[model samples]
Target: MKARAVARVLGKHVVMIVLMMFWLSVLVFCLSRMAPGDPLQSFYGDAVQSMSTGELEAARHRLGLDAPLWVQYEKWLSGVAQGDFGMSLKYKRPALEVAGPLIGNTLILGGAAYALVFALAIGMALICVRYEDSWIDRTLCAAGTVAFYTPAFWLGTMLVLVFSVNLHWLPGSGAYRPGMAGDVADRMRHLVLPLVVMVASHVWYYACMIRNRLLDEVRRDYVLLARSKGLGRRRVLMRHCLRNVLPGIVSLMAISVPHVLSGTYVAETVFNYPGIGLLSVSSAKYHDYNMLMLMVMLAGFLVIVSSILAQAVNEIIDSRMKGAERGGV
Candidate 1:
């Protein structure tokens, strides 16, 4: 029975992933091809203008751009099924070759930002809940609202100005010092500003969501009973309220991961961080269709994976909630 349940869950997620990939690939391919300006021209530069008609046709054929849109998409889709994303017109390299190094860089920067955001958002939300409409809660809510509305680029620029230029405390941009791969301190110094900017820009939204949810959960009968049973304020909030609130938090965090990864374009560009977000911007500028499509597919994959994980977590938490309701705790 357990095996059957697991299989059923896997099958559901697999179907969702496959259908999502199909539609995403079709939309991405069509939109990329529809964009103005010839990728061949961008790839070849001034030489493209000087080429004979026959030479241009040959170049197009070689790049598979001469094929009909449907045919081109089918061929690309086939390659994608086998984990191939074709070649980068700009770099004359495989898509993976161009994207592989940048993935790790993004994961490092994004992962750190995500961890800080998750931890601090929860902590801040709890504080707000504890204070419960006091001055501190009002102040935090206002600040979080400001942070949410503030453009990431503006925030990043302000950090650079104050910390790097005025205070001389942190590096303004780049991942690390030149030729300092093993210098942990220097690398951390470079990371501090961008990391803070990413965290500050994102934390408030999640914190606010958590605060509202905690407020609602605290009024539930279970929580009231826990307080009546001689549980202290912190105990009731942390043990009874937080436990029930955690699944929602997990779902929210998981859903935000893909968005955070995708949204890093502004932050990464501002910091000159060598991450996939920066790579995507460059690829878009150079009309590197293959690279751009690969990035899209990758982002989709992350969303699908996170969704599956979140569903599993939700199921587990639901079961626990049911058990608690049945006095089986």
Candidate 2:
């Protein structure tokens, strides 16, 4: 029975992933192809006029710009099937090679930032639920709203100013020192500011979510009955109340996964971090179409995968709880 539940969830995720990939591919193809000026011509600049007609044709052929859109797309799809995104027209290297490291960096930063956020947010939410609208709860909620609306870039700047520029407590920017003795320490230092910026901007969002869920759960019949049974608040909250709250948490987590993936572009680019967002901007400026396509597609894929994972978790949890109740043993 457990195996069947797992299989069902996995099947749904697979279907969703396929749909997401298709949508992403279509978007990538249309947007770049529709952009003003031919990419081949854009790559050559004014020198296009200076080139002999034969030279121009050679350049077009070399880049497969001469192929019809359908044909080009077909070729691209074939390469994609083989796990090749093709070579970058501008970077002059395999598109995947350039994007792989940067994607890893962005994921690392985003994962760490969100992990801290989930922990802090849940902790704060529990506190607020325990306190239930005291000065501290109201104050933090007020401050959190202000922080949530502030642009990530501005918040990041202030953090750098306070922690790095003024106090000299943290490095202002960059991933790590080139000749750092150990990668682990250097990475931890690099993560500090960006993660702080991420936490500052978004922690409130999750805190509010978890807080609202907590408040609602405590008011429900199960919780009230649990309280009547003389169970401590912590026990009710930790064991019983949270069982209901967690699905919402998982759903929200999944919903934000895409946002988390996309948001990295904003935070990383703002801080000059070595992530796909920064590299993506560079690729766009260079008309590195191949790299840009890969980046966009990859971001989309991650989002789809996140949603799928969320759905699976939901199904599994629901199935298990229902099963337990049915057994009544």
* Maximum-TM-score candidate: 1
Instruction: For model 1, state the Cα shift of residue 66 in Å.
Output: 1.0
TM-score of each: 0.90, 0.87
The lDDT leader among the candidates is 1
Candidate 2 per-residue lDDT, tens place, 233-300, comes to 88888887777788778778777887666667778877788888888887777666777788878777
- Estimate the Cα RMSD of every predicted model relative to the unseen true structure: 2.4, 3.0
- The 0-to-1 C-alpha lDDT of every candidate, in the order given, reads 0.86, 0.81
lDDT of 1: 0.86
